[model samples]
Each structure stands twice: as structure tokens, then as C-alpha cells.
Target: MNFLIRTNWWKWLTMFLLTYTVVGGLLFTVPRLPILNETIRNLHFHVPMWFGMIILFAFSVFHSVKYLSSKDLVQDLFSKELINVGVLFGILGIITGMIWANFTWGEPWSNDPKQNAAAVALLIYFAYMILRGSLSDDHQKARISAIYNIFAFAVLIPLLFILPRLTDSLHPGSGGNPGFNAYDLDSNLRLVFYPAVVGWTFLGSWIAGIMIRVSLYQFKKDSE
Candidate 1:
């Protein structure tokens, strides 16, 4: 009972935080700024997607490194599950951001540097999946995919974080551009925003856990 209860605590927390974020994020009071206006409310939902993606990708690569070191198929499975969820989040982030941009900037594809970088990152992972599919040997697939995933994450850091700042970007907080009041949320947006990140990230983990279990079951059934 204790083991079950302890292992599942974060699942409960994920549910609670997401409920709070959904209820409060939609109805909560937010700063009224020019250009952003009420769209700033997207900060809670959209931004968290990227945060969740980053967190999941980092988790993915960590397990990938473990797989490389130990050659454990379980670790490789975990890594794949993490990247699957991470890519889902990344796709959601890009779509939502594009919608937000379309409303605010009058075009869905503004060729914004940040958006381009995000697209590139997603493409690299898509290539990773393709590479994985091409291999017939499980061990060889795991070894090569793990190495590719590590490199993808390494490039992702700069593409997602550094490169945007180095160039002129329409995204908030790039160069002289202030991010919708420059993180000075005055505690209004942060309340929901922080929880949104936590909620979405844990939710991704929960989904990944389900995928991992299913994969393990299939692996076991195949072995038997």
C-alpha cells in the first residue's frame, strides 16, 4: 500500500495542478499590456509546452546516456518513451505559438528565428525516429539512436535558448525585445504559469510511464 501510494503521489499532484491551472488560467486576472492584451494568458498554456518539452528531452537524453553505458534495453525503452512525449509537447508548443502569432502578428509563419529553431529541433528528432526504424538489430539501434539523441539535445540547448537571443527574434526576451513586461509578472501570471509547467511536465511523465509499461509488456510477450 505504501509503495503504491508513494509511487503515485505525483500523479495526484499532476491532476490537481492542471485543474488549478485550467480553472485559474482561463478566468484569472492578468496584466493588460499592448499587443499581447488578453493573449498574454497564453503564457500559462503555451509556454509550459516548451518547458515540458525541454524537461522531457533532458530526461530522455539522461536515460539514453544510461543505455549507452549499461546497454540496458529498459533504459532505451524509457528514453524512447520520453522523447515521444517530448516531441508531442514540442509539436503542441509550436502549433499554439503559431496560433498565438497568427492572432498577434497577422501571419502563422512569420519566419521568426525562435520558431525556426524549434522546427529544426523537431525535425532532428523526426530524423532520429526514422533512423531508429531503419535498423533491424535492437542493440545496434539502441546504440546509434542514443548517440543521435544526445547530439540532438546538445544542439537543442543552443537552438531553443542561446541562438534566439543572439539574433533578432519576435519572441519575448530576445535582444532589446522585452517579453511581455520582461518576467515582471508581479506575481499575477507566475502563479498559474509556474504550476502550468509543473502540471504539464508531470503529465508528460505520466504518459511516458504508460508507454513504457506497454512496451515492456510487448517485449515480455515477444520473449515468451
Candidate 2:
């Protein structure tokens, strides 16, 4: 037990500090601000969680392309693992956003462009997974999954970011809603936000690594 704990100490420490920093930053910063009050605390978890989710999904798409180009099973495994982690983060983001919305907007969900766009993006990736499962042949599955991943990413760009900006939204930065621009965030917020993004991303990658290792082990055992 001691050896196991020692082996994983750094990851555990990093996660602990990440949690502490996020909570501390929110507690210190949000309460003192006039406009934000208690509601601003949500920013610490919600924004970074979504940002990490997007990053993981982007990595999954990249690995899917690599697998298609090289016909490497390892890349395919990595891609699938990344997709799993990305979905987890996506769910967390949705839950956090819903909580924030309920408190701030008096509703759990609104037909905001950003919200709808994010939902569509999630559905698109979910469809990619379904497409992969429908195929039986390994090579066919890899090829089809790769193509679908690429297509999903193409749609993701406009759905999550561009379309949200183009139309009116009940959420921030749309339809004259009060929102953060480049100038709106404080330096302190940036300090925590950047680390939160990096930490969550690394954590996702760590999870993907574990999944890939487990898959490899199972494959070896089955072959033996």
C-alpha cells in the first residue's frame, strides 16, 4: 500500500493542489467582487471543465486521424480512450452549467445558442461512437470511425464556438447578454483558469493512458 501510494504521489499531489487552488481562488475572488457575488464561483469549475473537454475531444480526433493514416491499433485505442474521457468531462460541464444557470438565470436550461450548440456537439460525438460499434471488421471499423471523427470535428467548430457568436443567446456574449470579453476577466481569474485547464487536460490524458494500458493488457492476455 505504501509503495502504491508512493508511486502515485505526484499525481495525487497535483490533483489535490488543483482542487485547492480552484476553491481558494473562487472563495477569495468571487466574494469580494461587487457584481459577481456568490454566483461567480461557478466560473472556477464550469468554464475550465468545458475547456478541458474540448481539448480532449480535439486530441481524440487527432489520434483517430493518425490511426487511419498509419493503420495502427495503438492509435485507435488511444483515440477511443480519449473519447471516453472527453465524454466524462462534457457531462460534468453540462451539469455545472445547468447548476449555474438555475441560480443565475432562474432556469436550468434556456434555448441559448451556446447551450444548444454544445448539446449538438455532444450528440455528434456520441453518434461517432455508435457508428464504430455498428461495424464488425477491425479495419472497416477503424476506417469508418476515423472518417466519422473527422466529420464530427468539422461540425464541432461551428456548433460550439462560431454559431454561438453569430446569433443571439441567453448565455453570455450573445444578444446583448452581459458577458466576458478579452478585457473582462481579471488577472487572478486568468491565473486559476489557465491552470485549471491544464490540470484537467493532464488528468484526462492520465485517464486515457490507464485505459490504453488496460486494453493492451487484455489484448495480450486474450492472445495468450
Candidate 3:
């Protein structure tokens, strides 16, 4: 009973928050500007995906660290599951961002620094997966994969943040638009934006949790 209740509570919250985000984001009052126009609503959808990806990847790294410390296969499984969901979120983020860019930026694949960095970051993690596939031994795979996870995350942080800031980019808080943050999002957008992040992250986590459980079950069954 307790287990069911605990699991259902966050699931309910994820649904509620996302429902509110979708409806409110489209219909709710937003600041009107020249370039952004109605597309500012993408904040509720597109941006959260990146946020969710970061959150999911952070958890993946956490589990990776744990795996290194304890050498537990379960930890490795959790880390892998998180990366899987993180990549899904990254793909969603990139697709949605391209759609948004086409309307506002006049080009879907403009050479935006931030976008380039994001693509590179995903590539880095994909490489980690490839590295895992190459190693059949579980112990070697776990240890090496965890190390790569940590390194990829370390590089990812700077690639997303520092590198973008150093170059001219269209993303907020970067490039020639030093004052972009001031004009980027107002309080009204934030009301939905913060919850959107939480909701999306929670939902990503829920999806990862489901994947982890199913995989673990399959592993157990195979073992038995």
C-alpha cells in the first residue's frame, strides 16, 4: 500500500504540472515582443526539454559515481537507464528547438554556438554508449563507462556554458546579447517555466524509472 501510494503521488504531480504547463503555456498571458511573438510559448515546451535532459544526465552521473564506488550492477543499470532517457530528452529538445528556430531565426539549422555545443554534448554521451558496447565484460564495462560518464559530464558543463558565453550566440545569457537575460523571460513566463522544468524533469525521471524496473526484471528473470 505504501509503495503504491508513494509511487503514484509523484506520477500524479507530473501529470498535473504538465497538464497545467500545456494549457497555460498556450493560453496564458505572455509578454509580446517583435521577434519572439507567440513563439515565446516554446519556453514551456522546448526549454524544459533541455532542463530535463540536464537533470536526467546529472542523475546518470550520480549513479555512475556510485557504480564506481560500489561496483554494483544495479547502479550501472540505473546509470544506463538515465542516459537513455537523457538522450531522448536531448533529441526532443533539439527537434523542438529547430522548429522554434525556423520561425524566429529564419533558419532551422543556423550555426548557433549553443546549438552546436548541444549537438557535441550529445555526441559525447553517444560515444560513451559505443564504448560500453565494445566491452563485453561487465566489470570492465561498468568501470570504464562510469569514468567516461564523469568525463563527459565535466566537458558537457563547460561546452554548454563557458564555450557559449565566449562566442556570439542566440541563446540567452550568451554571446553579443549580454542583456539578453533581461529581455528573455519575464515573471509571467517563469510561473510556467519553473514548473515546466520540474514537471518535465519529474516526467523524465518517471520514464527512466520505468525503464530501469523493466530492465532489472528482465535481468532477474534471465538469471533465474
- Of the candidates shown, which would achieve the greatest lDDT relative to the real structure? 1
What's the lDDT of the predicted structure labeled candidate 2? 0.74
Model 1, residue 201: C-alpha shift (Å): 0.5
Q: Highest TM-score, which number? A: 1
Please list the residue runs of candidate 2 whose C-alpha ends up more than 4 Å from where it truly belongs after superposition.
Answer: 1-13, 31-36, 175-183
Q: Per-residue lDDT tens digits of candidate 3, residues 1-224?
A: 11322467889999999999999899989998888889989888988898899988998998899999998888888899899999999999999999999999898999899899989988998898899999998889989999999999998998886788787777645644443374467888888988998999889988888888888898788779
TM-score of each: 0.94, 0.86, 0.93
- Residue 69 of model 2 has an lDDT of 85
Q: Weakest 10 consecutive residues, lDDT, candidate 3?
A: 1-10
Local accuracy of candidate 2 as per-residue lDDT tens digits, 1-224: 11222266557756975887667656666434544457666776787777878888888888888888899876777777788888888888888989888987889898877788778878887888898889998778888888888788888887787778778665654654335552256776666666766677667767766777787688678668
* Candidate 2 local lDDT, residue 84: 80
Which prediction has more favorable lDDT, 1 or 2? 1
Please give, for residues 1-224, the per-residue lDDT of candidate 1 as tens digits: 11222398899999999999999999998888788788888888898898889988998898999999999888898899889989999999999999999889889899899999989999998999999999989999999999999998998888887788788877766676445457457688988988998999889888888888888789888879
Ordered list by TM-score, greatest first: 1, 3, 2
List pairs with backbone clashes in candidate 3: none
